[model samples]
Target chain A: MDEIRIFAPATVANLSCGFDVLGCCLDTVGDEMLIKKNDLGEVRITKLTGQDLPLETDQNVAGVAAKSLLGELGSKQGFDIEIYKKIKAGSGIGSSAASSAGVVFAINKLVGEPFSPEQLIPFAMEGERLASGNAHADNVAPALLGGFSLVKSYDPLEVISLPSPAELRMVVLHPLIEIKTKDSRSIIKQNVSLKKAISQWGNLGAFVSALYTEDYALLGRSLQDEVVEPIRSILIPYFDDLKQVAMDKGALGFGISGSGPSVFALCKGNDIAQNVKTAINEFYKAKAIDFELHLSEINTEGIKILE
Target chain B: MDEIRIFAPATVANLSCGFDVLGCCLDTVGDEMLIKKNDLGEVRITKLTGQDLPLETDQNVAGVAAKSLLGELGSKQGFDIEIYKKIKAGSGIGSSAASSAGVVFAINKLVGEPFSPEQLIPFAMEGERLASGNAHADNVAPALLGGFSLVKSYDPLEVISLPSPAELRMVVLHPLIEIKTKDSRSIIKQNVSLKKAISQWGNLGAFVSALYTEDYALLGRSLQDEVVEPIRSILIPYFDDLKQVAMDKGALGFGISGSGPSVFALCKGNDIAQNVKTAINEFYKAKAIDFELHLSEINTEGIKILE
Candidate 1:
């Protein structure tokens, strides 16, 4: 009861239509973390490996997220944290979100489950704030609650967990390039035409319905981003060519994951996902860029307990 | 198969968050029309009553809609149409849509149903274009397909029918004053802040999810229109006062029905709907404005047959 080990998965945000609101968890790509209760009555990051991240309790994403939860309760109960990082920093696949969500999730269990998974979102968001100056729930939410999560509102912090279809799979490609969320976001215009805004919401609304009805084709048709993608996609290398090949290879939909450097192609089945992965791999291999490819099912369970 | 009488239902569009793409059908408030086959080899509005309207096939909404369907099929089949209009035009409750949707639905039946209710949407939309300069399908799609319908795309014209909750009710108040859709639309800014657009799509996506799960409270929370409501609500008299009273009376959510002059209060059940309606009636009466209030259930069956 004093110690716990878990898997903290990566996530894909801005799923084409629902910008800054929709995200999903990945099953196979994540980081492993260990948490142990300390009698010293102090929150500490005792071990950090595989990634050169801040070790200070006040500077680290996971450290800050853990302190936020403990500080809110005024409980001096402390813990020693260890993060075996696998997901790289600034790959745009919610790298910092996994660390933040994993630490809070682990600490909450050690304290006898004081809050529900939904309640853990804000605490995990503190990590996101430390990592990227903005406390966005799109990544940490799905990494906590799993499946598809929609941040309906931010002022009240309402996050709704959506149903995931069994056949859904994601083919993710990270080009080993870093795209800072802030720098990428700067290129986007502050104002958008009302006409395009209407189209965005129409596609997003249809996308939500497609989830409930399990209509894969409808989901694909609804996966359109006329507003943000046109502006932000320019930052990524060969973004347009990658999207075209993904769609031509039978991906249900394709878009820049989070702010970019990492892109995901949503597919109906593993067969199509593999085909898309291979096609993308072959297409990007000629670019002479160092990159990695990941194929994962929709992670229904967000953070998992390890043996 | 020579003669047919039918009831065409009214519809409420722009359900707050979904400005141009969402609408639902009303059960009790609509118009009745009668059509009889003729050997004149031309579409005609043989009789006109209840309200002043053009009888010419080119000028009339119903006649234009009917001709559009016939012309598309290259059919010379003629029909004598009698219009018994009950819905007042320019009230923003889809009055023109009822007549246009009604006539096309009846004619399709008379001609042995050459197209389904969904396929009849474009033909019904001709009536909308005749009534207004723009050919929007929010109202007509619901009146033809029944229940709640989302206009997912306008280019390829993909219309999706959404599930309606059993306890849902709508309280519609038409304040007699007319606000032209064109004029009302002009008040809305051509561009909106990206933050506001994100909020809008987030709420709309949640609203679609609420409809599927029948979560009434969530539906109420999701009925927010930050962009259009602030600009367009100014045209309606005592707009803020009426919305306040409806919410105070336990209405689920309230907003402008279409363009203006007409507003709708969404409530959970019949009792709440009636309470909201009565409160709105009393509030409007004090403003020295003539208004009509209607309480209606979500109409699952759009156009109905009559003896």
Candidate 2:
């Protein structure tokens, strides 16, 4: 009971038209955290692997999130945390969220689950703040709660877990390129025309309805982003071309995942997902760019205990 | 058949967060039209009742819509049209849509229904142009297709019919004050901050999801409209007070319906809808303003043949 291991999955935020609101978890790639009691009464990252992430408790997202949870719990109990990072940093697949959500999820379990999943969001968002300058929960919510999550409001931190269709599959391609979250976010305009905003909201409504009805065609038609994607997609190399190739290959919908360098295409079945992956691989191969492709069913169980 | 009769239900457009994209039909109020063939080879309005709507074909929404449909059908056949309007003009509850949609629906049937319900939208929207000077279909689509409708796109004219919850009921209040569509629209800002747009889109996504899953609580929570309501509600007297009363009386959600003077509240059952209606009536009575209240279930059948 004094030690626990938790795995937090990668997440796709935005989902094209649902910027800053919608996100879903991925089953194939994630981060693992091992938490063990320590005598020093301090929360610390004792070990790290796969990437050169900060070891400092204050600087690390996992540490920050754990510290926030501990601060709320008013517990001085010490813990040594080991992070086995599988989701790559700057891959735009919610790497920081996996870390932040992983620690709090593990800590909550170790402490007999004092906080509900919704209650755990602010703590994870605090960790997200350490990783990125903004305290946003689009990625962390899904990574912590499993399946699709909507950050309906951030001020009071209202997160809703949405239903995931059984037939849904995802094809994510990480282009092995780094795109700083802050830089990608800074490029977006502060104001948008009311016209485009209306169009975006309409698409978002249709997209959410499609998810509930399991109407894949409607979902595909609603996967458009006329606002954020148009501006942010310019930062990614061949984003337009990649999206076209994915759609032409029968992806129900495709768009930049999170902030970019990683793009995801959703499909109805595994065969189409494989086809999309191959098409994307062929495109990247033609350009001789190293890329990683992960084909997965939606991770309905966002973070889970590791046996 | 030498003649045909059709009824087009009234609709509530701009369902809060969905502004200009979402709408639903009402069962209790609508417009009725009768079309009879003649040898004159001309479309003419032979009779009008309930309201003094424009009789000239170009000036009338119903007449304009009928002409648009007939032009597409390449039918030179003459027709005498009779209109019996029950939905009040400038009520902000798709009065024009009921008229416009009624004629197109009647003519489509009289000519053997050459257009699918969806295909009839543009012609109906053409009718909408005669009324609003803009070819918008938020009201017309729902009036034609029944139930709830989302105008997903306007360029290629994509309209989606959303599933309406069986328990959903509506209470619409017309305050007898006129707010011109142009004036109401002119009051809104052309641009909105990205922050507000994100919140609006999130609510929109949640609202649509709620409709499909029949999650009444979620639907109520998602009925917020920070973008348009804040600006337009100022035009309606006691709008804030009426909305508060409706919510207090167990209405799921309340907001200005389209360009106001009229406001609608959604409730889970007929009893709550009646309670909301009584509350609204009390509010108007206190102010000594003449008002009309209509309580009804959502019209699942938008336009229907009058037997």
Best by lDDT: 1
lDDT at residue B85 of model 2 (Cα atoms): 86
Local distance difference test scores for all models: 0.93, 0.89
Candidate 2 Cα lDDT to native: 0.89
TM-score of every candidate's chain A: 0.98, 0.98
Q: What is the interface RMSD of each candidate, in Å?
A: 0.5, 1.0
lDDT of 1 by residue, A25-59 (tens): 99999999999999999989999898899999999
RMSD for all candidates, in order, please: 1.2, 1.5
Question: In model 1, how large is the Cα lDDT of residue B138?
Answer: 96
lDDT of 2 by residue, A1-307 (tens): 9999888899999999889999999998998889998989998899999899999999999899999999998999889999999999999999999999988888888889989988999999998898879988999999988889988877666787888898899999998889988888999998999999999988888887777778898889888998989888887788989989999989999998999879999998988888999998988888867888899899988898998
TM-score of 2: 0.97
lDDT minimum window of 10 residues, candidate 2 chain B: B127-136
